[model samples]
Target chain A: MNSVFWTHLVKDLRIEWRSLDAIVSMLFFAGLVVVLFSLAFDPRAAVSQGIAGGVLCVATMFASVSALNQAWSREIRHQVMDAQRMTPSSGAQLYFAKVLVNFIFVTLVQIALAPFFFVMYNLHIAGPAWVLALILPLGTWALVCNGVFFAALSIRSRNRELLLSLILFPIFIPALLGMVQATTAVLTGDNDPWLWIKMLTGYDIIFTTVSLLLFDVVFHAE
Target chain B: MKKAAFTLFPLITILLMVWGYYQAIYVAPDDALQGYVFRIIYYHVPSASVAFCFFAVSLLGSIGYLAFRRSDPNKAQIADAWALAGAEVGVIFCTVVLTTGPLWGRRAWGIWWTWDARLTTTLVLWLIYMSYLLLRRFAAGPQMQTLAAVLGIFGALDVPIVYMSNRWWRTQHPAPVFGGGEGSGMKDPTMVHALLWNMLAWFCWGMLVLLLRYKVERRHQEYAELEAEEALASAD
Candidate 1:
């Protein structure tokens, strides 16, 4: 509804749309994660059903980091942050825009990698598959929301790319647990996936709210 | 007076630590079940308690830093110093928990480690703070304290989630945990006394370290500020 958010979202989308840099690189990186994992774990094993969920989440985590690390690169390169500060709009809008654009790119990459997962792992969802539609996006939001915020937090760090993973992964651990366990539940029909899905949804809400509230503090900091 | 305290506090901490050790090793009755190995609780549990308490201190410091940064910049710096001191000391105690727990476990539980809920949560807490420490180390700028404070809050927020999730995961295939339920066996009064004594000693030691660290950080902060002011003057 706000023009600032839309303007930011549209600008980011147009930039990625024109260049396709983040998407292509992410797809390649995620695809590599899938292929390497398929080789190392041998999806033909009896345990493939159990592990496929973790593999998918791990792939998304790595791929999102690849994009998130540079999500602020475009702004930093041309003194865009200074201009952003001069604007009357709040920093949270800019944060949400970057998160959304990155989320879309990662989701596209996941969609592209879906066929590979299905073919490689022979994944057959035994439980409600539609919950996965709920699960994947929630898990991605958990990663991307924190990922984007931490990316901003570490934007001034010396080894930002490395620092980003270090800070992001540990905080991301709980969500990673929820995502993998929920997926495993859905795929195997062993446990109630609803419990884990709720956990993930709660985590997303809590951290996203924190990020939005703190974005101004981070954005305006000297 | 400050110099006297600086020297006397550490000396007192050392004496208390010695007294605690004597109470733990010589006075406390050894468990009939665990034998001499049961003594590790005096060290292990207290360290964990201190670790957890200091992390809370860090969280308070972080919040204080953020809340005071704009309105009270000087107070914010003090808070930032405490935040760093708390994390560093908490991490050291957590390290004791992780290491000595394994030693106690090897002798008592017959296994070194397990994927149990308490242990996993402790390990994850360690990691989250370790990452926080790393961010403080790697980050270089004016906003480093603000960023680290935000991360500290994030890390603290995750601890409960990690604990609950690990419990759920452990439920699927429950592994052995130290102590049957909440914590290990502390049914005896003498054992509780020993544990209480050691907790006091460790807390004393931890406080001495924490205050010493806070003072050092405050000094460093002042020096850095002075340098910045001088640089500004020279540039002008």
Candidate 2:
């Protein structure tokens, strides 16, 4: 319970609460993607049920990237980065707070987009629904954790938006694989979902640790 | 003498490549099963081997850059040069492997691609390095090296997961051609010998290009430093 970490996290949450910018656009983008997916794919009950996981994960990914590219723009503006650099606290706290806040934002959009899964795709869970609680959060955390870090990494680039996705997507494939596979299994109830869930858990643990460790270096390197 | 060796290296590499081509095309005996088409392995496998090897070089260079950047900046710049050179050259070789792989696959497997672990992992590896190069190209400022090095390490971390994907799931990519468990997969001695020569030739050629690229990058770093100094001096 470091005060710095807690304060930073609360500040970001409060700021976003005031504007609702990240969540609003994320939800809208995700909703559109879900509908677009239905139009592109067969969308029959049988086909949709099987592909529901992939569509949901992919929609979340695209929507989150839209939000993530702007996650640090506020800090970059108004000399907030310079002020933050002068603080005695470690940079990891700020990085952690940003990830946590963006995670909450993306999760809110996923929640809002849930109804589309039912109304449009008619996706039914063949396996236990409880696993969705564990898997979706884990998947979203994985995306935000890496997404925020790479967004910062690419912030100074000319192709900042494109660079974020280019670097992030390849690194993210394994976790995406896990999320898609686990979700698909749950939707279909054919294969055991544990393997993919375990993989997601591993991915979250590895990248979260690395991002926290390297955050200071990236923060001060400028 | 140093200048002489620099010129001689490439000449030797070219001669070895010529010799390797002769051994591969004329001296080596054919595969009993697939016959002439199997010769692609000599070029294809060697190119892949070089790509993986140079990627390791790039990783080590990145680690070295981060290690020395704070304590010894001169050493860090040199290390960064190695990192860029290894990565760029590695990408070129990886491109060759990706192209030649499908060519071989089209003939051997009767398909251009599959989502098997090896093929998928190789594609992912290519994507990782390509992004690394892109970051180097697109990013600016003093922080660029630090960011690129961090990314290099992060990308390397994925390699193990990619390698293990085959074990966790069934893969259609053929098992290791040389070191699949109990014994060497190739039984024919001439084929092995020819493959060895080609491997040697490719390694020599790759080394030449890597060194050339490293020299170029080092010069670029020095020139950039001088220009920065000039700009600051003029500002003052």
Q: Estimate each model's TM-score.
A: 0.95, 0.97
Overall local distance difference test of candidate 2: 0.89
Give candidate 1's chain B TM-score.
Answer: 0.92
lDDT of 1 by residue, B1-236 (tens): 98998898889889889989999999988788778987887898889989999999999999999999989999999999999999999999999999998888777767889877888888999999999999999986668898989898889999999989888888322233234665445667877787888888999999989998999999999999999999999999
* Candidate 1 A-chain TM-score: 0.97
DockQ of structure 2: 0.77
Whose DockQ is greatest here? 1
Residue B46, model 1: lDDT of: 88
lDDT of 2 by residue, A38-150 (tens): 88886897898888999999999999998999898778889887899899999888999899889888888888789866788987789998999899999999999999999
lDDT of the candidates, in the order given: 0.89, 0.89
Instruction: Report clash pairs, candidate 1.
Output: B179-B184
Residue B25 of model 2 has an lDDT of 97
